[model samples]
Structures are given as structure tokens and as C-alpha cells.
Target: MSTTTAPAAGTSTTGGPFSWTDDGAAVTVTLDGVQVLTYTYAANDPQEESPRPYFHPVRTRTGDLVSAYRPHDHVWHKGIAWSLPHLGPDNFWGGPSYRRGQDYRWLPNNGAMRHRELGQATDDDGTFRFAHSLQWVTQQGSLVVEEERSFQVVPGTDSSYTLVFDTAMTNVSGEPIHIGSPTTEGRENAGYGGLFWRGPRSFAGGSIIGPGGATGEELRGQRAPWLSFVGQHDETCRFSTLVMVDDPGSEHPEPEWFARSEPFACMGPAPFFSQEVLFEAGTTLHYRYGVVIADGQSDAQRSEALALAARELLAATQGRNGQ
Candidate 1:
């Protein structure tokens, strides 16, 4: 008995009948995707926008990308490159300056850079598919944080799609890769960038970003574990999906993040790494993440989604390397 399925309805995110594997552990879609990415990793300080200025979703049921993130400045996500690691006074919002030097006070936002490079995508398995890209961000000649992102998708019976992310970072320059090895990293006072998730208020913790339990000064919010960010209408959880991203080689390895953190929101340090991987010619690093988008947050749904996300991520990777 072969384990596979075809989306029931409304599951054609990229147009072509995105196949499935193991229920709904993942998903695959190829619409007008922009493929989000960045150069800098951490938004150490409050910048013009989010540390992750880019967004890429695998299966939105439409052959076209989502245009832009539904929320926020309509900053055009789906298929656009992006970055955020350091910076100075934000110029995008109000052109980065106080009308009056005395009233507003133009405080220095420090050094930060935003850059991105094109990524690769592929898919061959008749069951699933995937897409991969990269991001580059750094300060003005300060430090750089780059990300290699891969988006995978698994289709299910009820128009469900599981999304997975494989994340990796490399030191383009001949230097070491920082790590809070066995823990987070930073200037201590800088409160090392934490993996956080934003959820409802009643969910216990407010909107804060930091390690679980251990709160940081620049608190944002976090989500509960074993769950993914899914909307709710009445008693039903809409848009079922499970997304998991962990870098085994990362500082702490299996990063401690909440289950409800879908679409993903977090950061890490790369420049200060004592484990810097010197690049004689082209120094690069890598990380792998996983996501499972499914139907309603259910025990059966999540499991199925994970399998799908993993399969799609692996399947769609054929398009990389100009394959």
C-alpha cells in the first residue's frame, strides 16, 4: 500500500497538482514566489522593521505568491529577497531622522546591514516539491549574517499543505562562526538574540522574544511548544500547519522554541563565533529547518504534516545547482 494523496480542493497553491506524502507532513507550491532571504541574522536593536524582513510560504493554494505579508507595511514578501542584522537611524520610516535634533533626538541605531542573494529550488519526487533561497545582511562594513533558506511542502487530502524550512548560515569572509555553544551568544549586555514566537495574550506569555522561561530585557513574545501558528474561527483552528526549524550545528543545537511559532521568528550570532569556519576562497555555513503545515492542529494532522514537509523539501531541491 503506497502512502500518498492529492489535495481535495483549494490546495493548488502553485497551480500544478502538488502531490503529497505521509498524510500532510509537508506541502509544495510554486506560484509567483519571491523566495525570501537575508544577509544579517540579528536585529540586535530596534530597526525600521522586523529582523526577518523577508517571508516565503510554500503552498498558499494559489499559483501566485502572496504578493506581500498580509500584516505589516505590505512589504512584499512572497518572492522577494531581504535582510536585517545591524543598522543606524532608520531612514525608510520618515527617512530616518528627527525633524528637530532637540525634540526627537536622533539616537544612533548602531551598525547594521541588509542584503540578499538569489537562492536555488528543486523538485523531482512525484510526491512532494521544494524551493530554496538565501539572504545577506550586515552593518556598513561591520559584520555580516547570511541565511540559506529552503521551503518544502506536503499536500494532504483536505486541501492541506505542510511547509518546512532548512536554514543554514556561512561566513562569506575568512572568519570564525560565533556560537553560544551549549547556549545563546552575544555581548552579555546585548542579551544574545533569542528564538521567540508571538501568540495570543491569554496563551500565558505576552508578545516577547527570548529563550523559553529566561526573559531578556528587550522582551517581545513567544509561543508554546508542539504547535504551529494557526488562525481560529469559532471552535475550529483554521489553516492547519506544523513548522519546525532547528540547526543541529547551531549554538545549542535543537533550538528551544514554542510549537505555535509558525512562519518562524528568531535570530542568531555569526560574526562573534569562535568556531569561525575560515573561508580561504569562499567561506560558507549552513543550517536545516523543518515545517509541517496541515489540517487543524491535531495529533494526526501534525505528524502527517512533518512527513510531508520533509519530503517536499528534499524533492524540490533538484532545481538547485541549475539542475
Candidate 2:
């Protein structure tokens, strides 16, 4: 379930500020000797529920937890995860499967993405690179898709850092796969899917800012190259900002970002959204996103700059391959 690796030559092996460690079930990243994030792949529930890989307890450099996991209201909502509410007949997004006329209902068609391999690669400067191979399988153990997901962590000043999520998936079911969200199945503006982040309770009053100065519900279901959600922890009164930059090279360049300020803090760029995307057999789809987490309140100008920088970086690194 887990693998350990010795730091390569010229790399610090004394529990430095940025490092990766695997403990069979999850790979954790630590900053300045404090845990910042954990990528968990192990399935720890019945019916194979909550089996998808996710980042939990994402923290600021100062050690403030910014992400939440398995909240009572939405047990299937993990901390930070990549999922689709509607993937053909399989529910990889957890909870109930949405049907066209039947609405949302618990179904045995819930699938799980099993982590197959974990590997680390060397990176320059203060960045770390790693990857994961996962299989999307149905409850009956039927294969639907295979994904190669990678992450690059770039540490910034103080508790600020950038986490890049690069994912490449191929349809291995010998048939076309239809990807969509709950909105496509009649849920209205609830078109949430893809890379999702759930913030802590303290982030309830956070402001969702997007490119061009869009905020709050106005930013939802709208296309944006990047978006930022800033809020403070109710208990700690400490502010934090989370910025997501969409890769212009992605198949869905202008993805409609799903942002929320009430109920709970959550947002992400939903590609399929209200529409459906078909992944033909033998075809691969690639997506790239940049996430910047910092300890501070939401600043429109600064967040816009951060998003632009992230977008440029993703464009340069991914090039045309991400398209």
C-alpha cells in the first residue's frame, strides 16, 4: 500500500521543509517539519465508498489546516479530490448515483480508483515531483479508465506554496465514456466536478474571486482562467487564500468554475459541467491545474497576479501535450 524511498544524492534527507513520505495508505508532504498535506489512496470504507485518492488536511505554511474531510453533511466530500459526479453509469464522485429521470439515489454502481503505483522524481530548486498510477474500476471490478496523475510542489515565501495537478486519463473500456456532472442530469447550477477542494468551517465567509473581478455566486457556472477563494478560520481567526489556475492548454480551456461562499467553502473548475464530454476508445484526455495556498486574506490584485503566473507556468511546462 505504501513505499519508501531514499533521498537522492545532493538532496536533503533530514526532514527538511519540503519532502515526501509514504505510509502504505497515503503519501504525506511536510513543511518545516510540519505536515502540510496527505494524498490518500487507500479505501477505508464499506461498499468501497470514499476510495478515491484525495488530499486531506491541506495546511498553510504556519500549520493552519485549510482543508476538511468527510464532513457530516456530505460524508462523500473528501478534502481535496479529483472526481466526476457522472461518469457513464459509475459514480466515482461518491454518494448517490444520479439518474436522468430517477434523480439521485444510492446505487451499487459506485466505482473506486485503485492506486497502482507511486514513484518520485527529482526536481530542481525548491520543488518536489511525484506521480501516481490509478485504475478506475466498477464494483464488479470492471475497468473503465486508467489515469496517470502527477503533482509538483513549489514552496514559496513563508507558508505560501504552489501545487500543480497534472492528470492524463485514457478510456480502457473499449467503448466511449461519457463524462458529466449532476447539473447535466438536471441539478441546475450544481455542475461541480473535476479537482474539488473543501475548506474548513472557518472559511464559510470566504470571498471567491476570479479573473476580471467576478465574486461570490456571480463567479459560479462561469468561465474563468483562474479563481481564488479567501477566508478566515472561525476558531483561529487566521486568514488563508486558495487560488486555482486553469491550464489554457487543457482540452477545456475556459472551464466554468464552481464557486460557493454559503453552506461551505468549496470551488473548482468543472469541465464537463452542464454538458457532456465523450472520451472515445483509445483516446487520452489531459488536464492541468495550479493551486496556490497562502496565509492571508483575499486580495483581488495579488490573487489575479498569482493566477496569471500559475497559468503561464502551466502553459510553458505542459505545452501542446496538455491540449
Candidate 3:
């Protein structure tokens, strides 16, 4: 993989509402001098976990940690990651491979999305945007896909901020590859993948909000444009909200959502929830999502408003990129 020089540790500069510090392995973004989130491109996770880039310690503007990392139940469950469970015979989501008849088992099919090089970056106009080039390689050292991923942190109200994530992957393997989740492999309701988020332990039993005034785990496998989770913090007992919106212009406009609040609080727009998407050789797939992290609990109306704001931000970004 090609390498590039990373900014020196402690190197920081202020833009409009954001300032970022690069500590060699990660970039920590702060709003008004208070840390909000840290994106780690050089994660040192074990190969079995399919080491990949992730965002951890994601906090609301008020400093309440909403993201989790390396939790006991699922060590592979990072804070917020662009993870995929089944990529043909490879397991890019880490953990055990869910077989058709064998159930979950550790296989030699784990893959990693290794960072290749840094791309364009802009920290101005109350926003911070960056891109990265990555390689999706299987455990056997075979290249499967080349990806260009970009992230944008945009200014929002005092209680919230918007994070836009975009990924374009080109199949480089000679044969067709199928991307799917556990449900597609016969395991029921386990379709958890694609820009997944793992909430803090305290978030268990949190409230869920979706489009159309929907709520609860029943929203799982249901098509939705956006979803939000409201959870209370540990000590402060204050509430926070996380809203995720799937770009309507994506290949899968309104994807089925994989959400949970019982055992744990987690959610994501599962593009390949019930079926597998086949990518022929040399083909490309692109997806974009927007997330809003806010300090207070968001009711159905508030959640929808936040989702709309995120959608608007995403649309503006897409227009700028000529997508």
C-alpha cells in the first residue's frame, strides 16, 4: 500500500467552528476547543477483528460519550465504523463467520480494510472534510476491492452537528462478489452491517425513533429513510440523540434498518439486509449517509427535523462533489 506523511502530532489549526489535532494515529476534532469526536485511521485492532478505521468517543457538543469501543460482548464492535458482515466468503465485519448450517464460527475468512493513503482535506468555513484511499484485502492477502471514503463534519446548532460519510468501492476481484448480512445466510434478524454504530452500555433500553412516528425494535427490517436513538448517560443521567439518514440518491434509497435497544443500543441502514447484492467484476457500488449527534433527547418531531437537516447537508455536499 502507498504511504503518505501524516501531520505531526499535536499539529492543530482552527477553522470556523472546528479545530482538529492529528496525533499520528487519529484526528480529534473539537468544537469551540472541546473535543467532540476522534477518527482513528490507523487502528491497531487484531487481524481476527478485521482491523479497520473507526470513530470512537463520539460525544455530543455537551460532552456526553455516546459511542463505545471493544465492548465485551462483541470485541469487533467498534464505536462507529463502515463495516460489512459478509463479503462473499470474507467476513469484513469481524467476529465469527455465520455459516449456512454451522451457525457462527471462527473462520479464516476475515478481511481488513487497510488505509493506503490520505486524500484531499479541507478545514474551513465551519466544516472539516477529509478523504482516504483504502484496500479491502482478505486474510489470504488477496485484493478484493479498492475504496475511496470521505467524511464531512458540518456545523449545526449548539446542541448538534452533522457528519456525512461517503464510500465508493470498486470490485477488483476477477469474479463476482456478493455482499450480505447474517440474515441472508439463514440467521434470522441479524442483518447488522454498513455504517454500524455501537452505543455506550448505558444506552441499553434507549428509545428508538424512526420516520412516520415509528418506535421500538419493530422497526427492524423495516424500510426507513432515517432513524434515531435517544439514550441517557451514566452519571449525568441526561439524554442524547443519534440520528442516521440514508441518502435517498443511494442505490438502495430507503434501506431496511437494523436496530436494537434491548440487549444493546445500535443501529444502521442495512442496504443488504434481507438479500445479497452481487457486484460483478470491475463494478462499483456507492453509498452515502448522514448522521446527527445532538445533546438532548429527540422526540419523533425533533428526530424528523434533525433527519431533514442531515439530508439537506448531504444534498449540498453531493452537489458540490458533482455526484
Candidate 4:
């Protein structure tokens, strides 16, 4: 990874409504002096199972933390992370691996996705952009896959902001890599993998709104272009909204989403749910997603509007890429 001098404490610069500070281990983004997000790549705990890059304490514009990291119940879940439960013969989603008929079992095949390279951070037209190169290695330190991920943070309205996550991965083990979720291995309706998000305990009983007006557990196992979870952060009723939109250009444009409310809020857009996607040797696969963090409740109408906007943005980006 590249090395740079850590910025002094409390020393941050502003560009429009965004401010950021890099302390070598992580990059924190703030809005109007209020922290909104932190991208941690260095010094991650391997004991947590999947030592990978993740975004934690993702806060709304109003300063409410909507993202949770290393929750006691599911220590493997580290806020917003892109993970897969079953990757060929290795487990990268952490915890126990689900067997075909024997059910979940503890295995030593757990792997770690380590950050290997970091690109120079740049600010372009008020947007912050960065790139990362990571390697997925098993416990025995054998390479399974390599990924190039890019992140773009755009300042939105006073109450919201947008993050664009794009990843391109290649099979580096000289063999086919099979990507799947728990559901594909025998579990029913437990197709949770890929870009996952864990919410705070205060978000229990929160409402989940999707493009089809579905809510709560009913939203699980359903295909949707976008989904939003709105909840009160505390007794004071501080509302926060988290919206995730699947890119139409991705492998699975209409991916099934997994959502939960009890035992703490959590959700994910599982593209490889109930099935497996094979990545041939030396071949690459790309995926893109958009996340919106807002400081208010998102009703069905608002959620639909946001979804439409996200689709348009993705379409435009893809068009430019093709040109």
C-alpha cells in the first residue's frame, strides 16, 4: 500500500458540503463538520473471520450512525462489505460454512480479503474518488481471486449523500471460481451475501421500503431495483434512511434482496442467491451499486423517486464507459 503522512488531528479541508481526514488506517468523510462515513482497510481483525475492507459508522447527514460494525450477535458482519458465503472451496463470508445437507459447520477454509494496493485519492468537481486492489486468500495463504474496487462519494442535498461502489474481479487461482450464498448450499431463504449492511440495535422494528412497496421480512427473497430502510435511531426519534440501488449493468440487474428487523436490522442485495456464478480462469466480472444515506424517513413515493434517479445515474455512467 502507498504510504503518506497522516493529517494532523482536527485538520481537515472543506469542498462544498464535504470534509475528509485520512489517518493512514482509514479515511473518514464528513459533511459540514459532521462525520458521515469511514472506510477502513488497514489493521482489521482477522479473528473476526473475514478480514476485508469495509465501511463502518456510515452516518446520515444529520449525524446518526445507520451502519453497525462487529455487532456481538454477528461479529463477522462488518457494516457495509462485499462478501460471498461460498467461493469455490473457501468461505469468505466468515463464520461457519453451510454444507449441502449437513447444514452450517465450522471449517478452516475461511479466507481473508486483504487490501494490497491503494490508489491516490482525488477530488474532482466536489466528488471524492479512490481505488483499491485486494486479494482473496485462504487460511493457507493461497490466492483465490483479485479485485479492483473504486469508490466515489458525491455530496447530495443537506439531508443526504450518495456513494458509488464499483468492483471488478478476476479469478487468479488458474481455475474456475464458484460464487454462491448459503441458500445455494441447502439453507432456505437465507440467501444473504454480497454487499451487506448491518444496522444498529436502535434500528429494530424499522420499516423497509422497496420498489414494489414491500416492507419488513416480506422484502426478502424478492427481486428489486432498489430498497430503502428507514428507522428511528434512538428514543429521541431521530430518523435515518439507508437506500441501496442495484446497477442495471451488473451481472444480475434485478438481484434478490435479504432484509431483517428482529435481532437487529440487516439487509443485503444478493446477486448470487440460490445459484452460483462461475468465473472462468483469467476472466473478470464487474458489479456496481449505489448507496444513499439520508436523515429522514423515506416513504414509498420517495423511495421510488430515489430508485429512478439511481437507475438514471447508472445508465449514464455505463453509457460513458462504453463510449
**How close is each model in CA RMSD to the real structure?**
11.5, 3.1, 1.8, 2.7
The lDDT per prediction is 0.32, 0.79, 0.87, 0.79
Query: Mind giving the per-residue lDDT tens digits that candidate 2 earns over 1-323?
Result: 44343233223344335666666777677766667787776656555353788889798888888898888878888888998878887888888877778887888877888877765544445566667678888888899898888887777653588888988899999999899998888888889989999998878878998877767778889988889999887767879999998887766658988889888899998998878898899899988899988888767888887787777777766742221
Sort the predicted structures by TM-score, highest score first. Answer: 3, 4, 2, 1
Off by over 4 Å in 4: 1-15, 319-323
TM-scores, all candidates, are 0.45, 0.91, 0.96, 0.92
Clashing pairs in 2: 1-24, 2-24, 17-32, 61-159, 202-234
Runs in model 3 lying further than 4 Å from the true structure: 9-15, 319-323
lDDT of 4 at 190: 91
lDDT score, candidate 3, position 71: 95
Candidate 3 lDDT, 70-162, residue by residue in tens: 999999999999999899999999999999999999999889998888775567566777678889999999999999888888769748998
Q: Judged by TM-score, which candidate is best?
A: 3
Query: Which digits, one per residue and each the tens of the lDDT, describe model 4 over residues 1-323?
Result: 44343343333234455566777778887667788788886646764377887899798777888888878877888889888888887888888889988888888888888777766465556666667678888988899898887787776763777788888888989998888888888789999888999998999889989877777788899998888888887766788888899987775558999899886898878988877888899998888888888888788888777767766667666623210
Error of 4 at 46 (Å): 2.5
